[model samples]
Target chain A: MTIFNRLNPGNTANAAPNPQGRQTMPDNTANQATAPESKRPQAVAQPLYAAAGTGGPMTSVISKALKITGQLESTENIQVDGQIEGDVRGLSVKVGNGARVKGTVYGDEVELAGTVDGKIEAKKVVLTGTARMQGDVIHQDIRIESGAYIDGHCKPDFGKGGKASQPSLKAVAGEKTSAA
Target chain B: MPHVTHLCIIPFGVRRGLSLESETPFMFTLARTVNGKPAFARGADQDVSHLGPGLTATGLFETDGELYVYGAISGRVDAARLIIAPGGVVDGDVVAQDVRIAGRFSGRIFAPHVTIDETGNVKGRVFHTTVTVAHGARIDGRMPWRPQSYFETLKELPETYA
Candidate 1:
């Protein structure tokens, strides 16, 4: 049986340091700190593939000013930079700065740093830095940066006693999963 | 099919003709066709719950919110739905309540409702209760093959009457 595994951050590739100046883990582990780059996770020779079914926690990054007219589903991570005109379904989605999207996003965790013109569904949503949104935001936890521009309703109902804080993207990032 | 219970089928040698056992969430069943026949089936008492070939199953086929089928897969499914993306290939039939195909598929597919997109290329037979085919989509399969319903039989008369 031939098993093919994904090449992680520090694996065999032309992966330089993340532009955000974040340091990757010396070993393979999800809890390792990460740096950012020009737009998306910059691993030149690496292929972009994730586990199926965004029904879990997934992420995707739409770099550049591209456009997609279909549903984006991933189970672990999602990041959008270009433009999406459909539903974004995943566990977590991060819209980078200068990104423009016109679609509905549903997930357990979401972060926006650009412009969105649709509904946002997640357990928690954080709008930081250069975010400008115009839609409904439903989540159990929310943090909007002082400079963030949002023109929509916000709801943080994770049930009584914060029962709605089940799948936290922050937790996923902090807790260090098995994936590196 | 109300008596339908969740089943887990793993082949001993990845061979077909193995019966799947109902009542287990940890065991994932991958049906493959070898030499034009079911070839592999095994059973594991432990939870395949969090492991698959390489992919992850988020409540798509298992109970613990994970179903892993480490490689390419084909067969019948009815639960969290199966999505065949572009460049993904599946052989044989797929039966589910809802299906989204963006790849290449051959053989028969039975679903209560089916959606084939422009990138979908389906040949062989289809037995959907209701179907939606988009433009640029390719489907060379028969539609509306429910014989147990009287209304469906009436709907079938139009083709015969014409």
Candidate 2:
């Protein structure tokens, strides 16, 4: 079947073609990672928009046994193996497997492989094998591995009243819905 | 690594601009050196060419191109643009006046301007006058330093340019 070029507002020059043997340009490496977060490829005609190469979160690794007294602000990736007594602002953050954080985390993706004693506001949160948390969680997606401990409220970011954005829940670690 | 002394030129076809569609895998084989340099064997029945600065080529499909491991490539690629397609691997540093990356690239990259697409994964360091990275594309390195200008590219022209 031929897909006639429709003069619509949401058509793209690089639209997916049919099974016809027409040669297609290779997928531009530019449209890889973060592009899926925003404007994904949909069958329905919505305003086609995607933000690429915006230089994702700035990251830093805190190794020694120091402390952050004030607000820890960043726009990159960060790995913490020390102690913090403040708030964190960035993208994905990981508490090292041998560190402790005593503050609130505000970011997109937060992975805790160590210990946290505060609150968290993230889109995707992961608790690895060696993680221990005693705080509240507000997240869209979460992954808790075996042998992890948590001592606070785990509120699913269900948009409103448990109605999540996705039709079906994306079970990460083989289990569907459980707050533990 | 031995410093590149010279660059060889080969012609395949002439076009104003070329874009490699993803349907077919792009290949560039360096058959022989224009300067009679010894060619190292990377694979059997492979095209061979030395990658370096101040080099130019006319028209050659990227059936196979030299992969620079820890060296630098500073030159003007006219009519022939090295297209690193999706999953395409460039093992060394790449320095070009005009470049477009749409695959996986390792080592350092130096260009006046670079466009890294989503499927593009770059590791190592980079230096450019201008840079642009599309979403989903990844750069696992730092912006190190810039290369020579297009004017300096002409400095080697006393033998080839002038």
Candidate 3:
């Protein structure tokens, strides 16, 4: 019985009722034990995500086997190595080799080494040697590698023409378009 | 009397080791058990997907392999195995062969095997063939058991709960 209690500390309250046949004693102990166990998960859960990386926020990884069919928005960095059929918004977005995106990508910095069938809007854009972009790119700064394949216009117009008005308008318009 | 003391001390040492192992993140341990292999046995580059923190994805995610979510997702997910890490939040239906939830899940789960960790907070029906719920897990809905065939023939998720 002691071994059983040691194995399952949470079951102590349940075992008490069976052994002592005292209902009130078990109830009070159960409440006390449960109250802390419920809160402990939250505190303990934080370390798992933290341990995934060195420090700071961890970058989201969309691995190659996954396929997503909707909008992805992240405040932190995003690394895409899979397939996405909708818009993507992030601080720093990296489209890895063999990955594919069929819609617009919005980020502060965007790097592409895969295939994008739609648009890209960012403050800084880097098209690696393996990038295959088939639509327009709007960026404040752009770099296209020698082997990159681009089939559309490259416009250096990101964050231009009334910066404040453009961002709000673009955000509203982007959401409306995606919804429709 | 010395033999009795030795027996007690050994079990105490073993119990301490077990408690320490349990403190390791639930997702990592659950993944290895369900896969029946080391978590990274499959080369680190493929067959597994990770949705890291601070990501909010709203869509349908379909994968033939494993999926580990540490972020938030509000859509349908179909995978061979799904692990909701402790900080993750998923608010939609999930169809998988195996599912281990250590986070907040607010939708129905259709799986052959389902395990809810102590940190899991689940609020919808769980249709599982085999289920395990750890102590301290908060589940606010019914868990209905089904035969193994019930999951093998599940081509599409039911639109509404029966």
Candidate 4:
């Protein structure tokens, strides 16, 4: 990339196309570059491109100004900048700053930079500094950045199937075995 | 064939109007030039919602910036500017300042500036101040023209008999 390309933000030309260069982009910068610049994620990219929809390949965006009052589910990634009053299920869910969600968020990876009044269930969960989580976080791996507010519990029991999720069932099974 | 011609008989903004069907040359240019500025530039940084392909969202989506849907939404959408990309589908009412549709919309649209692309398919009423429909666009509803000032105060849509 030339010096002019360095100054101009529009240049996504892979002059130095390496895995390391994409990781250098900031979190917010990834959103900007998604549509106009490039479709590369700023960090570790997941291998779910084909799940983004084969018929029409586009990102389902919930713009910052939009407010939804019901459920949202997507096979592809969802970037939310608006307010949602219902649950959101997607492959990757990004809740932006100033955004508010009153329902649960279910995804493979969930990143919260806003206020979520409901629970978050994902394989990987990231709570940014501006995140305000008022409910539980059930995840296998979790990263809570500094300044993130949490008013609920954090459980690291996720994706272990029903055994990890069903404590009450285990108690019932134990009683049956003991009686026998 | 002209049962819908009654939609254009409002006579509210008849005196200060441009011919609706005969202005073919102007229909293609209005969406590109608004106060000598690119219409897409208005979407810069403000629009944050982009629904990519194959996704289906069913809810009430309200936004101040543009909402670009490449997949589908089966609920109400209220935005400042809404762009439905090619193959996108919206199955409910939409209220916006400016709406550019290249996809399929099947509900009432309340907007000031409405542009329908060639690949667009519309199936409901469109209340617009300035509308431009490209050729080959399939429209199955009425396009009732309104004055620009009416849209400025268009807080709610008026009830229709249908």
Reference contacts preserved by each model: 0.00, 0.00, 0.74, 0.79
lDDT of 3 by residue, A111-164 (tens): 999999998989899999999999999998999999999999998888877642
Model 2's TM-score against the true structure = 0.31
Clashes of 2: 41
List model 4 lDDT by residue over B19-134, tens digit each.
Answer: 35222212212222222223333455645567777577776775545677777888778666688877789998887777888789998988778988767899999989889887
Writing each residue's lDDT as its tens digit, candidate 2 over A8-100 gives 213345344533342232233234433564554232112111112223332354442222333444456666665555565555777878667
- In model 1, what is the error at residue B111, expressed in angstroms? 32
Per-residue accuracy of model 3 over B67-123 as CA lDDT, tens digit each: 888889998887668889888899999987788888899989988789898879999
Q: Which stretches of candidate 3 lie over 4 Å from their true place?
A: A1-54, A161-179, B1-44
By TM-score, highest first, what's the ranking?
3, 4, 1, 2
- Please tell me which model should have the higher lDDT, number 1 or number 3: 3
Candidate 4 structure quality by residue, lDDT tens digits, A1-180: 556655444456643453775545633465675554234321211232232335543456676546677667778778877778877878889998988888778888999999999788888999999999999999999999999999999998887778444233235335535754
> Which whole-number lDDT from 0 to 100 does residue B42 have in model 4?
41
lDDT of prediction 4: 0.69
Task: Give the CAPRI rating of model 2.
Answer: incorrect
Residue A81 in model 2: shift from native, Å? Answer: 0.9
Off by over 4 Å in 4: A1-58, A161-180, B1-44
Residue B50 deviation, candidate 2, in Å? Answer: 39
lDDT of 1 by residue, B35-126 (tens): 12221221232112222222221211212111222223444232224455554555554544345565667766655556675667888766
Candidate 1, B114: how far from true, in Å? 28
